[model samples]
Each structure stands twice: as structure tokens, then as C-alpha cells.
Target: MTVRNRDFYKGIIKKMLTERLTKYEEDGYKYSLQYNSCTNSYCLYYTCPGEKHWDGCAAVEASEV
Candidate 1:
């Protein structure tokens, strides 16, 4: 779908990612979706409640995720 408005696209991505992340956490996958402009895609990076570094585990695209 073509999103003419930038904010609208951001909102949709945020909403969908939030839901997906919540489901991931509930499913026992300790990964969180982080937005990366450099990669230009949403990915599941390893994240802990108080940890950093993403554990070197790259985030995958939502479709592949």
C-alpha cells in the first residue's frame, strides 16, 4: 500500500509492531522489535528488560519475522 502521509505510515508501523512484539513476548521469544532507519525495516533484535546491544542478533523484517 502506498502511504502518502509520512506520519500515517509511521503510525501504522508502530501499531502493528507493538501488537507483534506483544505477541512475540507472550510466545516466549525474548526478542523485541526495534525500528532502524539504517536498515530501513523493522526487525526482532534480542532485548532484555535492562540490557543493551541487541545481543548481536539482527532483527528480521516483519514478514520474515
Candidate 2:
């Protein structure tokens, strides 16, 4: 994956997170958005350089925090 692809995925994730965060805020839920990122090392069949993906993205839940 080229820089363009990496950026594209990042943008997508950002948008998704932003939308979700906005919803949470609108619902009067206070929380922090936290995400765990990891690379796809096991799926080597379609590996691309500089390509990264995000997983385990979740909110910290203000109540829990």
C-alpha cells in the first residue's frame, strides 16, 4: 500500500470515529475515544507496504473512566 492508500484508510477511520463521537456527545454521554491499532502481518497474501489498519476502536466510557 502506498501513502495514498494509507491516508485513505486513515481518513475513513477518522470520519467514522468523528461521526460516532458526535453521536455520543449529542446523547449527553461524556467519554474519551480510544482506539488500538495493529498491522496485518498474518495476512501476507495481499500485503502492501505502508498499509495499516485499525482495530479494537472504542470509547473509554466516561462513567468507567
Candidate 3:
């Protein structure tokens, strides 16, 4: 990811946790919470608006929040 992308994601993550939000969307990116049965926990999932496939997808484990 580019430096801009990295910073954007980091900022979103920080705001999400601070505001205790389950979902957030900004600047063509969407972040949401999903359950991971294998991990037996919830994770934060984000998707870049224009990306295809998983190129712009990522997850943040609940523990990381």
C-alpha cells in the first residue's frame, strides 16, 4: 500500500476504536465488524471502494483493538 493508504487506514482504525464504532465509511473506504468462527472472535474488516478482489481488503483482530 502507498503511504497515503497506510495513514488513512491507521487513522480510521484509531477513530473506530476511540468512538466505539462497529462500522465506518470515509473516502471510498468501508470498515465493518465481522465474526471469525475460526478465530472465535470479531474482527474489523475494511475494503477500499475501487479495488477488485482482495487487494484492498484487510482485517484487524479484536485483540488488536
Error in Å for residue 63 of model 2: 24
Across 1-65, the per-residue lDDT of candidate 2 in tens digits comes to 22234343344435546576422221222223344335311111122323343222332222222
Q: Candidate 1 lDDT, tens digit per residue, 23-42?
A: 23322324555667776666
RMSD of 2: 13.8
Q: Whole-model Cα lDDT per candidate?
A: 0.46, 0.32, 0.62
lDDT of 3 by residue, 1-65 (tens): 33355445556767876888878878776677555778755555666687644344445555554
> Model 2, 14: alpha-carbon shift in Å?
0.6
Q: Candidates' TM-scores? A: 0.34, 0.28, 0.47
Cα lDDT for residue 1, model 1? 14
TM-score of 2: 0.28
Global lDDT for candidate 2?
0.32
Error of 1 at 34 (Å): 0.5
Q: What is the lDDT of candidate 3?
A: 0.62
* Model 2: residue 51 alpha-carbon error in angstroms: 21
Task: Arrange candidates by lDDT, descending.
Answer: 3, 1, 2
Question: How many residue pairs clash in each candidate at the backbone level?
Answer: 1, 2, 0
By TM-score, the best candidate is: 3
Where does candidate 3 stray beyond 4 Å?
1-8, 34-43, 50-56, 59-65
